[model samples]
Each structure stands twice: as C-alpha cells, then as structure tokens.
Target: MVHSNRCGYTYIGESGRESCCYRETWDDRERCIWHEEIAADETKPVEQLERARAPPEVRDLNGETGPREILDGTDVRGTVFPDGMDLAGVSLRDTDMAEVGLRNATLTGASLADATLVDADLRGADLRGANCWEAELNDIHLGEATLEGADLRAADCSDAILRAANLEGANLEGAFFDRADLFDATLSRTRSYGAVFSEARANEGTELDERCVYDHNSDADATRQRRESGAVRSDGGQASDTTVAGSDIDPLTKAEATYQELESLCSENALLSRQSQYFVRRQDIHTEEHWREGNWSRWLRARLSRAVVLYGESPFRVLSVTVAIIVGSALLYPLGLLRVSATGQPLMYPSPTEPIALVSTLIDSLYFSVLTFTTMTFGLYSPVGAGKLLTMLETSAGIVLMALLVFVFGRRATR
Candidate 1:
C-alpha cells in the first residue's frame, strides 16, 4: 500500500504497486472512503477557492501575456518554463531554467539574473538589453544572435558558438569564452573587463580593448587579404570559382595540368617517378653519433649563443664598421692620397702626381685601406714617401676605433 500526502489518502491492493497512484483503481471500500474525504475537504474551502481561482492578472507581477508567457515587468522569482514556452521580457530573478530552448525569441530587457542556461540553444535570439548576470551559458549556441546593450556579468560562455553574433555595447565583465567560436561577430564598443578569450577567433574590425588575447595565426589570411586589397573578397568571383573547382577537380585534370606545366619548363629534360628517382649511394654523410646527448635547454642555449655572436649585436656593430670603412675609402680615393696595386692589396700611400683613372684600382685601394685600418694587414702594399705618415695616422685611428667597438659590443652581448 502507498499513501498520498496531497489528498491524505491510502492506495491499497496490487494495483498500488504502480509508479503513480492515479494509474491504479481503488477497491470498492477504499473508493467510498476517498470520495467521502474529498467531499468533506471541499466544503470548508470557499476562501481557498477565491484565492486559487483569482484572475492571473492580479497574481502576475510583471503583467505579461498568456498561459505560456509571464507578463512584462512581472517578478517571476524562482519560476520555470516547463513546457519549453517563450518567456520573453519575463523578469526571472534567480530562476533555474537549465537546458531550455528559448531560440528565436526576443528577450529584450528581460532580467534573468543568476539563471543557469547550460547547453541551451538560444540560437538567433534577440537578447537586447537583457540582464543575464551570473548566468551559466556553457556550450550554448548563440549563433547569429543579437545581444546589444545586454549585461552578461560573470557569465560562463566557455565553448559557446557565438558565430556572426552582434554584441554591440554589451558588458561582458568576468565572462569566460575559452575556445568559443566568435567568427565574423561584431563586438564594437563591447566592454569585456577581466573576460578571458584564450582560443577565441575574432575577425577583422572586431573592436577589442587590452583584455583580448589572440593567437599568431588567428585571422591571418583575412588580415593579409584586407591589407592587400583594402577589403576581404577581391577576385571578381573568378578566384572563388577556382577555389571551389580546386576542391572538386578531377585527378586526371590535375595530372594533365601538372604535365603541361612541366613540359613547358623542362622541354629537354626527362621526367622521373618516385621509383625511378630512388637512387642509393654508399657515401658517408657525417651523421652525429650522440644526437640525443645534449638536453633541449642546453641545445637552445648553444643556438642562442651562436646567434648572438653571428647575427645579433656583434654582427650589427660589424656591419656598421664595414659601412664606415667603405664610405671612408670612397671619400679618400677621390682625394688622391690612397693608391691601388695591380694585384689586389691593402691601400698604399701613392705618388701625389699619379692619376686615379681606373674604377678597379679605386675599389682595390678602398678594400686595402679598410683591411689596413682593421689591422688585417695583408702586407701586399706599402706607402711610399709622405704617404707613409698618413697611413700610420689612419692605422692608429682604426686600432682605437676597433677597440672601442669591441668593448661596446661585448657589453651589449653580456646584457
């Protein structure tokens, strides 16, 4: 036997074994007792009838329409939409409507404070000016929806698909959009203070403040196209057709095109396949025996050291010095003090009367002068007469300059 607290009645017999008491029929004596109790219970409830059968307009706080709808501005505290009906503009404070389908509905100015919308399909819905404070909207498909001027404070929208949605002037403070697809969505004037978008894809013109985190390859193609053409699509529709054709192009057509292109380039050469090109030789290719001897950190440190020495601060300083030497030689060559040897050698002090005619001779003199100043003294040429004194002064200046450069470079490298 099962007892029902609603009617204060006891259900007896094998029929009472069912899940619901209404599914079973009462025995003759039990039915008589149930009817008598119900009749007596109804007699003393005139005031209770008035309260129960009162107009819904007086009961509803928001004055919203319909059996499926709550009146607008009604305070539906802790109410639920069990029939999957529209509750647009219903002020549901602290309501629990988890996994509800409020799709394509206009929830304009609705107050859904602290509501749980986990796994809800609110796709293409107009939630303009809606207050979804502290709501849980995990995995919700809010694609193509408008949430203009809405307040989504402390809402969790992790992994939600908000593709092509407009969130203009919305306050998304402390909201989580980790791994969410916000592709082609407009976020102009949207304030996302302390909001996280770790792996979200935001396209061009999507206004973001300092709080937005983006990946390296995020919208790279679109960005490049926009930069090159000043717009996204720019192929006159032919490029789009080609792209679509490439996806569905036959293997025969691809092979024929490849053959034609190869034929034009290598008219005299022979074409080889994978098997034909597979030639093995017994040459020792200097393989490292202890490939895994060094740890990744150590290898990285060695690479960084080499890069610093070869391509970093030192190289830049060297380049600057080289440029200075070249410029100085070019300047000095016209002055007639520097002379070039028939054989390529360092610059030598020449007879002041000798005519500087040859371009090659000037280049050789410049190369030698730079070498002499750098203290690389190739010893192939020597200054004669009054030229020796000038050479000596230049060599001394070069040594001092080189020393200063080395010191500066060393300090920079260490830093």
Candidate 2:
C-alpha cells in the first residue's frame, strides 16, 4: 500500500502542520495528482473518464495562468512535470525527480538537496540560489540554464550537458564533473576547490577566473560560514562571491595550477590549439604577480615574451615588430648616422659640406639602415661616430627578432 486516495500530503507551516484531503485519483491509484507515485507507477496513455484533474493551485504558472505562490510548499515530490512547472522557492529536498521532463521550469531558491535528477531534462531552467548539494545530476541536459549562485557542492554532475549555462558565483566545491560538457559555459568566480573536472569538455569560450582561488582554507565551511558572511551574490542571493579571502597561499600559484590543469585537459582531448591560449594567459598572470613582488628579471622576461611574440601565440606579431624596428631605424639614420666609406663624408639632411638632395639622402639612409639592421653592411657605406652605437643596438634587436620568429614559426607549425 504505497498510497491511498485521500491526497494525504503533509504540509508544515509556521502556525502548525496539516494533511491534505483533496478527493481525486491519478488514474487507478488511490491519490490525488499532487500525491501520485509517479516514479513507481508505469502507465500508457489512454482515455479515462474518471482520471484525476489538476488542482486549481498549480494551474499553468509558466504560461501565467496563475501566480507562482500557489504551488509553494506543496508536496509534489516524485511527481513528473512533463510540460513545464514554476515551483520557485519550493522546498522539495530529497525528491525522486530522476528522468523527469522539467524543460524551462523556474525553480529559483528551491531546495533540491540530495535529489535524484539523473537523466533529467532541465534545459533553459532557472535554478538561481537553489540548494542542490549532493544531488545526482549525471547526464542531465541543462543547456542554456541559469544556475547562478546555486549551491551545487559535492553534486555528481558527471556526463552532464551544461553547454552555455551561466554558473557564475555558484558553489561548485568538491563537485564531480567528470566527462561533463562545459562548452561556452561561464564559471567565473565559482568555488571549485577539490572539484573533479577529469575529462570534462571545454573550449576557448568557457570562461574561468584564474584569480578565483576560494579553497577550503579561504572558506571556513560550505554552509555555516557562508551564511554568516551575508554577502549577496550577483543574482540577488547568497553565493560564494564574498570579498573575504585568505592569503595563506599565493594567488598566482593557484592561478597557474588552474591553467596547467585546464591545459592538460585540452592536450589530452586533442585540443592543442587551446593549450597555447592557456599558456599565454598563465604567463600574463605570472608577469603581473612578479611585477607586484618586485621580481625584475621574471617580469622583464615575461614582458619581452609578450612584446616579441605574444608569448609565442601570434606569429604575425613577430613579423610586424621586426618591420617596425627596421622602418624606425631608417628614419633615425638621416640625422648624421651614416657616412661614405670611400670619402668619409657624413650623410646628413642639410649636408653642411655640400647641398645634398633630401629625397636622395633619405633613399641612401634607408638603404644603409636596412643593411645595418641585417648586419650585412657593404664597403660602400660606414657608420659614423654616433652611428656605431645605433648600429650595435639595431643589430642586437634584429638578431633577437629573427631568432624569435623562427621559434614562433616552428611552434605554430606543430599546432
């Protein structure tokens, strides 16, 4: 006797507790629609004149037939919402909602802790601030859903399809996301300490905050300390986005760890192109961190890497910078930087020794500048007094640029 026809749903309120007595029967079962044992009962669609009718309370909330308040606190656990449902702020912890069709449902602030939501269809659902701790969410289709600030800590989300979902500031600590698809998902500010992302699928569009290192040490406990902090989230609820942070570990260390972890994931999934993207970002954070700590050598190397080849990500930039150097050096050469090797005559714009054509002087200076930059000067021209120093600088810069270009080209070819 799993159920009776008295609609015996219990509801506890601030005043007292009460049991429902709605006279209805879901098919041949001895219960109302709200009290139906949907998980246990097997059925086939058929015309039955005595079938149960939907109560006036939960009448078409998503379609705006009724307000969202009527269905709150109702015991609709183990019930399937095939079309769509609006149960915002509903207390439905520990429900057997596995394999249900909840497409486009509004469950904001609902308590779904320990619920079995395996293979459920929650695409485009709004679960903001909903407590879903330790829920079984494997293989659920939550594409384009809004789960911002939701508490999904320790939840089993393995094999879940979360494409384009907004999980910003959500508590994802210790959650298992193995083999989950997170393509184009926004996980910025998510507390993902001890969270397993093994084999999880992501791309360049997947947003992750390198500086979000909210580990267990930084956050005292999941529930109690967070509630005490009273920090409101971006979605108008309490989330893991509080400004309180601990300095026990360097932020760059955690940021590098995150990048390395993701980079390895990309490499294993044959997404090698995304690996360089992560590498450049990792170096950026490393450079910024070292600059603040006064590490001149590390900062200088990182800065040079960016200026030369964009940390070896952009091969085009290498060629562009080289061209810029050559053109700039050519313009600087006309200011008495070159001389004739045969006559030892200085090459200047006005030419105090003789009236030189400005156009011809510029052409000659450009030719000399190109030869000096390539470090292959002929006997027809020579560097004058100050030109010797300028030539040395230009030659050094050219050598470094050429070497970096080769390295960048080789790296890009492998990718």
Candidate 3:
C-alpha cells in the first residue's frame, strides 16, 4: 500500500521488494518510489510555494526618485524585469514584452531591436535614443512617452496610440501604422519612408517631410484638383479665378460644375460604348439601320467631344494656341493692324509691304483669338483705329472660350 502525503490518497498494491517508507502495507513489495514522490509533490498547494518565493522589500540605497537598473550588457536581448525599476542604458534587443506595463520607467539609450511590445503600456516612460528596429509594437499605448532620436525602423505599430509622445528624429522607415493615433505627437525630422498609413487620421500641421509618402484618400481627389488648377496656390497668393482679361469666378463653384459635367460625360460615354458594343457583339444584327442604332464608337466620340467643349479646350491645344497668339501679336504690333495709342489718340505705323502686313495681321488675329479664348492677357500689345473694334469682338469671344475651357479642363483633371 502506497500513501500520497500531499492529498491523503492511499493505494494498496504489490510492492515487488522496492524499499519505500511512504508505503503502509505490511507485505514487502517493489515499486517506483521516486515517481510516486514526484506525483505526490505536484499535488501540493501552489500558494505555499509562491509565498515562500516572495522577496522581502529591501530599503533604498539613497532614496532615489526613479527606477533601478538591474541588468547590463550590449547583447542583453530580452525582458529584464527588476519590476518598478529604472533600466537606463539597458540593451533589450529582440525581447518580448507583450501586454506588459512599464509605467513610470526610464529606459534611456536602450537598444530594443526586433522586440515584441504588443498591447504593452509604456505610459510616462522615457525611452530616448532607443534602437527599436523592426519591433512588433501593435496596439501599444506609449502616451506621453519620450522617444527622442529613437531608431524604430520597420516596426509594426498598427492601432498603436502614441498621443503626446516625442518622436523627433526617430527612424520609422517601413513601419505599419494603419489607424494609429498620433494625436498631438511631435514627429519633427522623423524618417518614415514607405510607412503604411492607410485609414490613419492626421490633422493639419502634421510634420510630413520629403521622406513620407501619403497615399490617396477620398478627399485627395478634390485636394489634387485644387492644387493642379492653381486654385489652392501655396505661394501665399490669393485664390483668384481672374481670367487673362481680369474676369473673376468662384474657384470652388467652378470646380464643382466641372466635376459634374465630367461625371455625366464619362457615364454617358461608357454606357453608350461598352453596353452597346457588348449587345451588338452578343446578338446577330443583319441590317445597317440596326448597326447605326447600336453605333457605340460614334456615340462615344460625340459624347466625349461635347464633354471636352463643356470642360475646356485640351491642354495641348490651349498651349499651342497661346504660343501662336503671343508670336503673332508681337509681329503684328509693328504693322498698322496692331497699335497701342495713348488715350484716345489714333496712331498708325504702316509697314512697307501690304501683303506681308496682311499676313502678319492674320497671324496676329489667330494669336489674339487663342489668347482671348484662353483668357491670358499678355499686356504687350493693344488695338488702335479699326483694330479696336476687332479687339473688342475678340475679347468678348475670348471670355466665352475661356469659360468653356475652364469647365472642360477642370472636369477632366479632377476626374
């Protein structure tokens, strides 16, 4: 018979001559005494062992105000929990501290490279100049923490709340920061090349140096349009829609109109071309009338042309016209066709050859038409005599053309 001392469970069995003092039966029997002892020891209360292992509180050496560093080394790559301790200059590379709280601690100059700090709380901690390269720091709260000049390159910090943290000059290259809250955090001079920030919310005045690459957001389309159209000029210039002839329009209102026109045209063209083409290809149509009825290409071309006119002239075409107008006007200024008279005075400087002057005048007219159409006033040439009437007509025509061009170009660019 064998008795378990820890739980008081007794068993009667044949002990084949194995000597064991824990046995209660009178028969001499052999048994695995060492194994029985291990089984009995495992059943003992765990609380008793925990109580025995508790360390007594030692008096502070000099009544210091911060945590104490217990471990030291360059290759110290793990958690060193001298709990409630200050571990300044400790090297904790490749350590796992998931769900651990290191509140009110100072780990200045620590190298925690490739460490896992998932869901860990490092609130009010000082981790200045730490090397945390390629660390897994997802969902970690480092609120009010100091990480100045830290090397956190390629760290996975998705959903991490780093509110009011100092991360100046930190290297965070290729870090995954999806939905991370960086409210009021100072990221001046922080290197974050190729960092993922999908769905991340950052307010205005967020420091985004040349190292950062911002992905397209839903509002990005509007912002980009405003930028490209010179509607949101960053040179401190006023956002004015003054045409070449000094006609003003609301920038935002114009953008909205252009957007709507482009959207309509694109939808119409797609429906006519794609749907009609698919239908024609799938079904056997024998008559020419049927083919004309389902003429997707012609319909698309017409719709696109209308859209182009509504939005504005094509960029290349507008550029070509502007150049032609400028050159022609310069040539025509010397001729009698284009002259600038000072205040109600008639001045005509007739050139030598009438045919040459006429040709120059025609070129000038074409150039003037383009400029008027584009609403770009060169201010170098003016009309005198009969040219004044022609200039008035061209100016009026130019205003309409410019308006149309703005509408078309704005829609196309925004879309």
Candidate 2 Cα outliers beyond 4 Å, as residue runs = 1-79, 164-174, 183-197, 202-254, 258-275, 351-356
TM-score (all chains, Cα) for each model: 0.37, 0.68, 0.41
Find the 10 residues in a row with the least total lDDT in model 3: 68-77
- Candidate 3 lDDT by residue in tens digits, 141-244: 88888888776756788999888888876755456778777766777655443455655545433333221111122233433333222332111223323211
The segments of candidate 3 whose C-alpha lies over 4 angstroms from its true place after superposition are: 1-85, 210-415
Tens digit per residue, CA lDDT, model 2, 204-312: 7887764444332233234323532224332232333222231133545655665666666677666666677668767787788889899999999999889879998
- Given candidate 3, what's the lDDT at residue 210? 21
Provide the overall lDDT of each model, using Cα atoms, as 2-decimal numbers: 0.49, 0.69, 0.48
The TM-score that candidate 1 achieves is 0.37
* Model 2, TM vs. native: 0.68
The local lDDT score (0 to 100) that residue 286 gets in candidate 2 is: 79
* Pairwise TM-score winner, candidates 1 and 2: 2
